[model samples]
Target chain A: MPNEAVQYLLTSQRDDGGWGPYPTLPSRTESTALAALALRLAADVEVGARASATSGARWLTETQLDSGAWALGDGVPGPNWSTTLATLALTHFEGEDGAAAAGGAWVLGARGQGPNLWSRALGLFLRPSDTVELDPDLKGWPWVQGTASWVEPTSYALLSLKRLRLVGPAADTRAHIDEAERMLLDRQCDDGGWNYGNSRVFGDVLTSYPDTTSLALLALADRRGEPAVTAALEALPGLAADNDSTLAMGLVAVALATLGGDPEPIRARLRNQLSTWDGGDIRGLAWAAIGLLDGSDPLGLLDG
Target chain B: MVSRRRFLQAGAGAVAATSMACRGRPDPWTPEAAKKPANSPVAILGAPDYDETRLVEVVRQGLGICGISARNLRVVLKPNLVEFDPQGVINTHPTLVAAAIEAFRLEGAREVVVAEGSGHRRDSQYLLTASGLQEQLDDMGAHYVDLNHDRVRRTVLKSSFTDLGELYLPETVLDADLFVSMPKLKTHHWAGATLSMKNLFGIVPGAVYGWPKNPLHWAGIDGSIIDINAALSGRRFNIIDGIVGMEGNGPIQGVAKQVGVLVFGEDPVAVDATGARLMSIDPWKLRYLEATDAFLGNVGEDRIEARGESLSSFRANFDVVTAFEETKVEPSTGGAGGPARIDK
Candidate 1:
């Protein structure tokens, strides 16, 4: 994928103080959520670099709805997906109670009542033995073949909640997590994985890839069931390192690190993979850093 | 014993799994790491003679006292192969390696492999070939494997004492029934001293880690030699070629001295400590020794019983190149970076 495209899909702001669609067009939930995240990342980078960190924050604050929810524009704001990202984004502005708590509450609510998004985004928030509450975080979901519900937004929400040690309605939470895990597992093509939207409700059909498998593994690791764990292990080997997306490689490292007992082999693979990266991939680095520091299995436990 | 057969059947793989069970150390796969314990002690020997013909004999006696049989054992002898002036006394001498090889064969060693990993930027094989040990290896029907590129690898290294992550070791050396460390006596800039244990830095792989074969060097923990040796659980031996010593900026570029004393031991640390004492330096101040002492739970003279030559009996000129002062003017070799900025 184009670096610009991934950046656009991930950024939290647009030039006009509005959020953009995942990659291109400006939309309500994604654009707002993305803009919020961009603001936080920008602020962090600037703090370390001693550059301006508030431009992104300013954009986020300007875009927040009166209900303390963030939106792409002035629309009825209740979509929890946008709010979850917004909450996470605002998590950076901890000093501003009005904005920070608004964002945190949205995250907590969505985590408690929203869909499961624990795999791809907001993963840094998760820890072992965590359950979070999430409120519905999006509205007017977009899809190509069918109507959308909690799959996409819920995945992001679950990750957000998992990070903060909050997840709930144990039965429903398990069910949503289970369905996503199964669709991903059951959709494994000949080579042992779903391509695009197989695991993701809005999975990447155009990118039938191991990166998607990588995401599924992260989710499965957190969702945790004997079958899910087993299926994940089976699917892990199917991931090709030379694929279009290295995202899978990193996630595979995480899952293997978690499931495998002797980490020497896996650690070797991780070092080999990490050293090869161009070092500009912040998202990839985030996961790589976690793998290096701590993973589903605390990395310190293994000595080769 | 739960079926001696089954316990033995669960090979290094089981031990690898156990190594996986500990944490709190650096990932050894990377060049930098935390100091760790070798789990088992290697024999350390002090010598009454630094004579060329008697060097290997003293080493053998040290191993014998420590209960490691040099006879009929597949052995890999590793030495420092850093690129430096031969006359500089900064490098391991060819004759020292030759002595060990001949003695091992005489003792009925099944086969011998003389291996070394030189400067990460230089080929280790070239150093050995240049030092003329390759010829010695061939003469004895022994083989030479450059630790830098050889593909022998196995993982089961778990330091029971530190958080250093699971690490991999060269398969040839790891598989050998007897591993012998043969390092020239020298003082270091980082580890503060180069002894039998410090010489083990050559065991690191440049193929996997690239240049700067040691990760602890990068992590600001230069005493990696101590941790790496401490973590070694395999049956190994230590032999110091102190007949001629290199002091100041050692293990690479240093000044040559006629310390004229050979030290040997079952414990890499103990032998190294004795080497330092013979040089009239305190072993406690050494980076590797300090790190080893912390990991081993104590640092005292009582734990060590010296044999062969007393520390006072051996003396050498330690006025050699300092490790940090040791710099090379790369020869005018041309490559991808164009003409080498060669200094004479």
Candidate 2:
């Protein structure tokens, strides 16, 4: 990571020890998690980086709900998708196992709502065009409890589960991971990448987005040999290049590096892009750090 | 005999009221008050295309006709910037947004900010760049707020159309003195038509509610629209972009349909009703507008005073999906006879 970008993330921590998407915004779980992860990645060489990560981790633990989930913050709903992000950040710290495990448990129990019997009947008899071609009963993570599953949240949840070492030896956690993996595979667009959720909507095939596609690829890194994963890997560079977004490009670099693809070209493009980048988007900056900096996979997705 | 559409709509309303009662929250307005709403003026002005100079004058004229007050008020313009479509059918055109900002400034507004919590895209920077809104805002020296990441305040719903009792809305929306909803006049596969009222869904923070605001969809799209609009009842205005709209499957993935008119009104229900009418749709048949008619604004034609260009002059047929065929008002059958479908 560039010294200036590292310094910016370090100095921008709020009094509550969290980071917002940008300065002047209230701190949020997702933003703070991204910042903390970036700082943890920088800890090896940058001074004060470890301390900042610890403080951000402390805020995350402090704000965790009694039900073992983290919300976006005040006024936002609880036990939502950010719990995965918070849990992932907590895994980096020592003595934070209890909080992180509790989060993992909550995530394990959380399930996205699918078609009920009544709705299934309606779809079969009346509303055929409204239904997408996916297993209605296949459960995955949702942005909120009782809502439909989406690609980004499900991918993040899988990444969090993997980081917590919950997936192994064909246990219950492994079963859940397998189900979510299937869900992600089912949601992949015909273009070989994933959309926000549905691959096809109302008979029209939805196109893939670089950001969601990258996250999905990162979550499914272990299955890189699978046809879907291979196809998406082949499509990532072009999509990222076309998007011209720091967030998308950075995520693409991270996914490629983690999946053992040739990330050097995308990283080179990302370097040029970040040099002239002037936006104050913290996620974009944090992603640039995670992708550009020398590091083992920060979230431990590659760890056994 | 009541049609199947009316029966379903009535059933939905009853369920909402029953749920509200079960939750111990009395509705602020009675159904009788909803039925006898005072007449509101909706102005429809003709504009051929997105010529910035011509749109500025037309917007000013429409604002005047709708009786907008902008002196020293902090205005927030929430235009539909949902996704990028090369045909330019998916979002409200940037020229219209720039025109609205200029017209508001000419009307003596203190400040105008363009805000939208994009329902589909998480990356606001990408959406802005892809839609050309960033360039427009930069050129006009306007501020833009990504409401998804903005500070929020929990607000209790004034009306209970959904079981979601309250929503954490962005402070930028709630604090604005004049909150203007600039929606692309288009057909939604689920909602029949997404107008100024339906556009209010963007104000609900995705940071809180998540992308696409699925809770709103799950609670029911029509009811959520009523709930959000009711929450912000008094401090709202509408400017429907019908100059070049969308038809068939929309809110996204639809073809462009040009109507050559802009619809404006203080009452969102009336403005949306006029917008629906311009697309040859029956507003009375739409569930949200029907419920909104009971209290929020006038969807009834007799209760809306037409201003500027006549409604019939700019009437254009908008093709809808197979499901929404009933939503269209047939040229020969132009009365209160169209059927409405409830999206589950």
Candidate 3:
């Protein structure tokens, strides 16, 4: 099944050496990064994985913005959210250390400064809700600069930084990573899983999503024994148990495996799910492959 | 009360006159022609209920008035699938999406694809299932495209509202012969209201823009709306799902405010302006509408020819959040510097 998934990903790669969310879409950095990471992790289990991963790494290095970050692609402005994934993919391969370091530095510097005093003060009176319990002062990585921090992007940043070992070695870097972790913890809903950003808004408790919850937990993988982590893990089943989302299922499998929990069920489910996938969804195939690869840290590849 | 026959006759005359005015131009429906009172006829039908059969008829009639003949055209219906809440009407009703698909098919559409890139959540499958849109799409045998993950083309903007000069629009959006803005009329906390123009935010894929498409928000919501509206100038139409709307704080996180009416028009600005009026919001007060008034078509009530139901007959004051209500600008006086902000 992993071999088939890898073949799907390899075949799905465009002539540009990048993959898109779907086979029909143009090659995007996000899908390409995910595909590269999956192919790298599955090299031992499948043939041609190494070759595909090399081409993907080349695409990442070529597309890196002068600012040391990757844009969303096709001139969509930014050194934005896709940067972390691109950085991680580049760092996994040989001879790309220079590009990887620059990308890593950009990710570390991308932490958004929490909204200004005026914005915060105005928020107090704007649609005041009893259901939401988030602190306005906690800062994390935003999808873009000068916007409220969201869980998924923040988690990706954390995962990438941790993989690069940039979480320490400098006072400011450590502080930034610490604050981001705090922000993630602070935004957890009463229901135990995380939403996109706001836990509650205007007295309505926002529903927790499986993909977000899985990503948040994956970022906090080292702290699986913490009370919050335990609570989130317990709450995850309710959110994700019956979920047919390939993205969510893949993330959950990786997160559970990292936390020393049984990922077999999720791995099996994802494997079965991918069998029916008509080879168009590159993201799903990439995630499914990464999730099913046993005892492999796709994010931690080449870190040590 | 304008009769349907009279409205169609007037529309035909305007089309002919515009065709003569721009003889060599590729598109006869120029901005000047679209703004003419005879051209921009908005259909405001009294749905009074969410009955699928009745709503389908309303969509058929409204699309007809707007001159949306679907023969051989690949139509894309962009519904407000921003978030899903079974208990709350956060998304466009699945019944409405189904009705539109059926109506288009009956009108001889080559293909009618239902697409949305939900801003609030990346899990589109969950949203599709939770909102019951999946079931409807399945029953109708319609294809659903997650616009956020679709192939993209870098499009240069002719008019930029924010610092961004270019945007990566989904290939699906660019491939369509006709793009229908099927938005749920609601009060937006940041932008005053999420109608036709605001709903276009979903067309920007999350694969590029991030969930909630934060880049656009950072670029300034009003400016991005104006920019996207300008980019999608021609081949754009608006059919607002006003039958059940969210008010007070919306796009997500608002209580349902049932307006029980379906609003439709060829001119997105005029349709949205009329929608704002139905919600008791002054269209001139919205920053985006005010800024793009010249080229985007008229938001003024005087420029739009109302058909079917009257505005006053279905008027409901949707509760605007304090933040948006505070940002309201005074009506434009045809002066320099655009509409001025009245000191509250």
Per-residue alpha-carbon lDDT of model 3 for B192-236, expressed as tens digits?
Answer: 899898999999877766768877766567767877877763476
Backbone collisions counted per model: 82, 1, 3
Candidates in order, TM-scores: namely 0.43, 0.93, 0.84
On residues A1-304, what C-alpha lDDT tens digit does candidate 2 reach at each position? 4544566678788888888987667788888988888888778878998999888888899989999999887546666688988887777777888888888888988878885332343352134356566776678899888877889889988888887884232225888889999999988889999989888778888999989999999999979898889999998887777676778877887888887777778778777766776646787777777877665454567764
Question: Candidate 1 chain B: minimum summed lDDT over ten consecutive residues — where?
Answer: B332-341
The DockQ ranking, best first, is 2, 3, 1
- Model 2: lDDT equals 0.81
Window of ten residues with lowest summed lDDT in model 2 chain B: B1-10
In model 2, the runs with Cα more than 4 Å from the true position are: A1-4, A75-77, A116-130, A166-171, A276-279, A295-298, B1-37, B331-344
Which portions of model 3 show Cα errors greater than 4 Å? Answer: A1-4, A65-67, A74-80, A116-137, A145-148, A166-172, A296-298, A301-304, B1-39, B48-50, B154-161, B290-295, B324-344
Alpha-carbon shift of residue A271 in model 2 (angstroms): 3.0
- CAPRI docking class of candidate 2: medium
Show pairs that collide, candidate 2.
B34-B294
List, residue by residue over B1-344, the lDDT tens digit for candidate 1. 11111211222123433444353344222222222234333333444343547766765565566666667889888877675354737666776777788777778888878877664323233344456666666666676766654443444434322223544456667777888888888876445567777787777654333234423343223324544675565777777777667766455445667766666656666667666665555555443454454443222445566555445445433443232222211122100021111211
What digit string (tens of lDDT, one per residue) describes model 2 on residues B198-240? 8988988887788888888777677788878888744678899
Candidates in order have lDDT scores of 0.47, 0.81, 0.75
Candidate 1, residues A5-74, lDDT tens digits: the string is 2232234244555443322333344444443443343333222211222444566677666666664333
Candidate 1, residue A55: lDDT: 46
| lDDT tens digits by residue: candidate 3, A218-296 | 8887677999988888887678787876777887877777766677878787778777766545776777777788784
